[model samples]
Target chain A: MLRSPDLVGKSQDSLREAFGKSLILLAEDYPSLVVLDADVAGGTGVHHFRKNFPDRFIQCGIAEQNMISVAAGMAETGLIPIVTTFAVFLLRAYEQVRLSVAYSQMNVKLVGSHCGLDVGPDGGSAQCLEDIAAFRAIPNMSVIVPASPIEINQATRFIIEHKGPIYMRSGRSPLEECLDNSYKFEFGKGKYLSRGSDLTIISCGVCTGRSIQVVKDLKELDINVELINMSTIKPIDQKIIIESAKRTSKVVTVEDHSIIGGLGSAVAEVLSEYHPTPLKRIGVKDTFGESGEPDELACKYGIDQVSIKNTIINWLKNETKG
Target chain B: MTKSVKSNVNYIRSLIVSSIYHAGSGHPGGCLSCVDIVDYLYRYHMSYSFLDCDNVSRDRFIMSKGHCVPTIYAVFCDMEYISLSELKTLRKINSRLQGHSHRVAFPQVEVSTGSLAQGFSFAIGESLGLKLQGYSNNVYAMIGDGELQEGQIWEGAMFAAHHNLGNLCTIVDYNKMQSDDLNENIIKLEPLQNKWESFGWNVFNIDGHNPNQIREVFSAAMSKENQKPSVVIAHTIKGKGVSYMESIPSWHGSVKLTEEDCRKALKDLECTDNEIEVLMSA
Candidate 1:
């Protein structure tokens, strides 16, 4: 029952930092907890965990594949090993994660930091736009993308308590705080920040904050839109998504990832199979991202609040005319 | 080798041949090659009972070369983890004994390992965990010479050495042959002993088929004098014990065993008619 801080208009905090902090807190209770990093402790912000719990922290040097398998082995021996590295680099160990962690059903926590175009100057190679899809395809893997710093902390605690393998996504830059102080995190459940009747905006990770801003800005034009944070991308909250789609016959799915097999594709699968609805997926189309500022990349990739606002406005106008 | 150890080795070889023959497909060559080492580990080396397979203090064994799991399954049967009758259902639908080591199907297995090189890493993690937990038990991982081609094996080697995991012991069934061709033709794993030594392991090269040599090497590996991880590079013939299959790459995987083939293999192991009858019936 951790209380979230008042996150409205406050200075943002890094989700990666919160991940390290949460590990410190979790280690206090679970002695079996261990942290492993692949030469990215400073980059992923697990340096705090390393500093605080030196004995509990394992620094695997520049080997993502071995790090994952080592974590799997640790989990096999009844220890909870949290493995952190750059999201893009995690793809190098995709087979290891699949066979060693997921197929074995080991209780290893995989935290992929600096995900998507938000990695900014690190460019297309560093940015991990396909991690969610890669991990989501693996059986027994729970894919979670925390919307804000507070949600990241909550998700961290929730994953440590919940058993089995998990893949959690975090960003490099500080993200806008969105959850209220009383917000309680739930696994595989979506939270509606604002509700309206015109249409529903579904987003996760950093994009959820931008979607909330888009909803607020559209309110000036009397364009009432609902904002839902679909955090758990794998075991996605389909009940809330279907209900939201039924209420507002249109949907817009946004994420700071590739539109092919990410949040957009996941929602599309749900809607097409269970409830057919007119949907517009607002995220990176089939294209590779370039090096730029975080905000600049978001805008260029059409995932920022302004892009989302314009896309919805145009979609609404067309839908009404049709 | 003691009389009982010799009997155990022969029984395991018989089981491996029979299991693969019944399944109509499996890596019989590597399984036969690695059976002697597996037998030594289970029958003499490892410290655990069948009734208490989940004992925390028990030594951990990981078969990294997962295709050769019939040898491990034979060891498991000897340990009474599963019935001899169940070994007949090796790759059958819904059988607990999967084609490879599956943790869910067989909880006694340290980790599920089929996709090569990954299991070695798991062994490293387990060794690290054991050390952190203040456990005195050693962790043993077995890999194929061909599996050394996978990059993760080197990565695990580096990590184990870096961590100074003295409690970890890795065995490589250095059979000259791989699936399609000789290891030298496909990937030269020669200077393999030097590779492990440079990675900071107490490397031991031994005749894998000789149970006495395997026992001596394992004992040396377990000695408290060594401060680094140990890897026993056991030189063995692929498809050992079976004359027709020995040193043959075609026996590496999915060898369709005819009645004559089965008889020839069992006869090579010197199985009696009654023993062959029981094996075939199962």
Candidate 2:
């Protein structure tokens, strides 16, 4: 296990910035590494890569479908093309990603930034709560949601080295750094932050940070809860989840996505298939997200640290009483 | 055109007709319409060796209008990419030849593209990729007149031209007919040449069926001094050789061909009885 980074006094950083910086560093070693972006180069933070490596960077304008298919084509000729755009806009080219990238099994990395309700003020149209479900359904496609700037940077290096199709979702706002400098990202493994026997809190992406904070508070209250940061949603860490389910006999999944097919649904599928345990999935119900502050949206959507803490406390109390 | 090349085109047309007829389903009209252009590229223009399909610097062809891929399968069979016997197994259970192009099953296919307007973008990328690696090899992509209604085609046109991808060439099979009606009736693409020019491509218009015109336009597009992508607007009939299927919009997709219909189509292509027997047996 990697040592946890000190949470206090550490400035937050957006995952998009980390992704852009990582691409520039990755291009140093991988000569064939190329980055393609839609008109959202600035928004997705690939503008940093473009300024440094203009020869390797392609501004694909506002056309996501073309960017995706072009990335697939570049991949065909032994190039690693990382395509980026807003999460919601990426779905506009879903068929291109499905057929050209995923179906062909091309070595293309798709980075969808500004995912989930955290993309505040852009409202329901911009927030992509279903992206996780949409990408997970495609075969040969690996889905990863990095919880912090450090994790996103690690994921960028990992995906550049890994072959095949991958979709990594990142948030618009800066997130608290959760992983220490020593954390190594494995493709299908979840990082265990805290171990306890009473209950397991499975989470991913920005919610993982929030869940960890909540779990720390619960520990002081004598509520022993295990926190598992499940970054890889597809090909999920089934062993860790099954073991945790058997150990705790109870599980709760939190994500800044739709409850139907995001991390919660993924955990539920595993537990139900292997060792059935009492499970609770905390995420947005099937509904659109309205314009609001990112923090306000997180609380309203029931993925905030306070809501998670309350839900766990209530569930644990109910179980103990029964 | 040489007598042998003419004969090869006819053979490819026959293969397309027979395979679609045998399968009892497929887009025959578009397949027949685009056969000559595809044949011209594979026979005269493309640089891939018959034995080694993995040549990195070899010319790449993307069938953007992939539903009409029976024509490409016929050409591939002639090229010996796959056995001629496999043509009979098209769209069959566990067949390598899927209903649409399957890149996994057929490694020679650069990308699996049944979706319209997407393959053209892939070709643009391949051209860019080759260019970035300092390889001067060309990439050819074929699109249907009707498939131009898709917005992605214009997006690719803008990107390819903006990047000055001189090695990228697009052939629009301007067959006039689409799935349900003429392209004009579905969506007006008139002044199409100007639209491509405005999008920054070197546009060439030609009679799609004329072998000499096809060769000349391709040569001119390749040898042009301009550093822009080229799009050859090849005007073609919906169905070129077969009499009853030609220029008919309803024949855009599958039209059930009776045994007599197959016989007449083959006769129109001047297929010998022995050739017909071989195709039927396969």
TM-score of each model, in listed order:
0.96, 0.96
Fnat scores for every prediction:
0.83, 0.80
Colliding residue pairs in candidate 2: none
Indicate the TM-score of model 2: 0.96
lDDT of each residue in A1-322, candidate 1, tens digit only: 2223322113377788777767776777888889999888998878877887899999899989899999998887789998999998888999998989998889999999989899999888898899998999999999999988778878988888889999999888886687887776789999888999988999999898888889889999997888899999989899999999999999999999999899999999999999999999988888888899999999988988899899889988998898
Q: Model 2 lDDT vs. the true structure?
A: 0.87
| Candidate 2 ranges beyond 4 A from true positions | A1-11, B1-6
Residue-level lDDT of model 1, residues B1-282, one tens digit each, is 112334677778888898888998888999999988887888788886667777778898899999988898888877677777898999999898889888877777667877998989999999999889988889999999889999989999999999989999999998889999999999898899889989999999999988689889999998976679999999998989899989989999867787778878988888887778788884
Instruction: List pairs with backbone clashes in candidate 1.
Output: none
Model 1, C-alpha of B55: deviation from truth (Å):
2.1
For all candidates, what are the clash counts?
Answer: 0, 0
lDDT: worst 10-residue window of model 1 chain A: A1-10
lDDT for model 1 comes to: 0.87
Docking quality (DockQ) of candidate 2 = 0.86
In terms of docking quality, model 2 is: high
